[model samples]
Target: MAAANSVWISLLVSIIIVILFIQAVPTAHSQNDEDQLIWAKRVVSGNQVITNLQFYFHDVVGGRNPSAIRIAEAPQTKNSTTFFGSLMMIDDALTVGPDPASKPVGRARGMYGSAGQTDFGLIMALSYVFSDGIYDGSSFSMLSINPATETVREMAVVGGTGLFRMARGYAIARTYWLNAATGDAIVGYNVTILTYV
Candidate 1:
């Protein structure tokens, strides 16, 4: 009877341990997800100006023209509040020339410099799917407009979070620098591009 009782007690202890483990796992996962969300929010809020400026350029350039542009993959989020976003510098030189469909002019005058203008800074914010949720933190990168290739390659964070499915949302802002001599003539334009997955 003593031996039987001891075995029963041991079995009970083992069952209790298993139960505790199962309960703890979910809590840990929840905490991790929460922490990620917080980090993302901080990043997004910190760069609000950059994000706003990019959108302003997007509006001015309109979808018809491909001014300075950067494209990035969307971020992944289990819920509505979690997402990723990015900003890119715009290169106007690539887009200023005559449309490829049009005949070449006798001499193409350089509207802007060979290299397009760079943004003061680009900022991005990840948007939540639901209207009520807060924006997720943003991922940042620098953009270089390559006239030869007619492409804007985002340098910083190129292979990082901005390129993966982990990014679910994005926003962009751009600032244009005008020449004082030209009386605030639009000398340089900055563009920010945002994407949401």
Candidate 2:
């Protein structure tokens, strides 16, 4: 009886350990997802629309190369537009700079462009090449638009030629979020364009 009781206690302890491990694994994964969502929400709320975006370099090993780029955009209610208005502009250069005078230039149009077309022209121009978990190339400047005035404003630069150029393809992953109040029609259409230069 004593031996049998000891064996049962050991089995119960093992089962408890397994249960704890299973629970901990998911909590760790959830933490990462939570961080991503928080960052996405912050990008959606900040002013200077398209306020802050960043890129990081991953050390390469052997013959393998690694890098990443993170692109974020924040469109405030003030910049929100009607279903028929323009949302952003993409130029041929890294336009957004520390100085307000150094912003890039691009034609302004609606999110879907004229006639309700999917204008991935900006993403195409920036993403010159796409490969397995890697995007090799460079892109120009990106500009944001003011829905009210329809004027182009310097929002942020994805990949510039100078110091900013090093940030190309630094973000290996991306996440996008839209305000809950903004109906799915308009929310799903808004995008932040980044170059994998």
Candidate 3:
């Protein structure tokens, strides 16, 4: 009977500890959420710092092992001049140089859709996941329109994880090389981010 009483006490203590721990941890609330304006608590703390990064993205759209593949399309996509309503998923390589043989540092994984009816524009929603150097295991989310005809375009950096928690900024992307026949391209990216240091 005494041993059974001790076991119950231990279980009660553990339950109390778990409750306290849960209460001590704050819940996450999005800044854009309406409820956040009423009851949001400060959860992140660090010195605000800006960092600039430069890299290259290699997109292989053709060949046996392609990085970008068309996943869906509208009924009239083949007949449309802009390929509107087409969607593609990509796992493109991020490299240190414009050449595909250059050292790989990370990957860009996401989906892009041809949403423009009159122009060749893509709505990009991707994450730049890093795997090299100080940025290992870090990643940032990007969302913006990529005007394929433009020489340069700016992409929005909305949020991130790991070393770039709560990140926000922009990335300037420029086409470095392109194969009109194969639909393969190398794009250079210059990213500027405001993040916690």
- Top TM-score hit: 3
What is the full ranking by TM-score, best candidate first?
Answer: 3, 2, 1
| Clashing residue pairs in candidate 3 (N, C-alpha, C atoms within 3 angstroms) | none
Over 1-197, each residue of candidate 1 has an lDDT whose tens digit, in order, gives 99999878876865565455333332112322432321111112222211211111111223555443334423432222211233323433211112222221111111121222233222322221111123212223332232322223232222113312232222221223323332121211222323333
What candidate 2 gets wrong by more than 4 Å, as runs, is: 1-87, 90-159, 165-167, 183-197
RMSD of 2: 19.2
Which of 1 and 3 is ahead in TM-score?
A: 3
The list of candidate 3 runs beyond 4 A from truth reads: 1-46
Question: What would the TM-score be for candidate 1 when compared with the true structure?
Answer: 0.18
What is the overall TM-score of model 3 with all chains considered together? 0.76
lDDT of each: 0.27, 0.26, 0.79
| Stronger candidate by TM-score (2 vs 3) | 3
What TM-score goes with each of the models? Answer: 0.18, 0.18, 0.76
The TM-score measured for candidate 2 stands at: 0.18
Score candidate 3 by lDDT: 0.79
Give the per-residue Cα lDDT of candidate 3 at 150.
94
Instruction: Write model 3 residue lDDT over 1-197, tens digit each, in one string.
Output: 99999878876865565455435433323334422221111122235555566678998999999999999999999999889999999999997666676667899999999989999999999999989777889899999899987999998999998877899989888988999989899987877676876
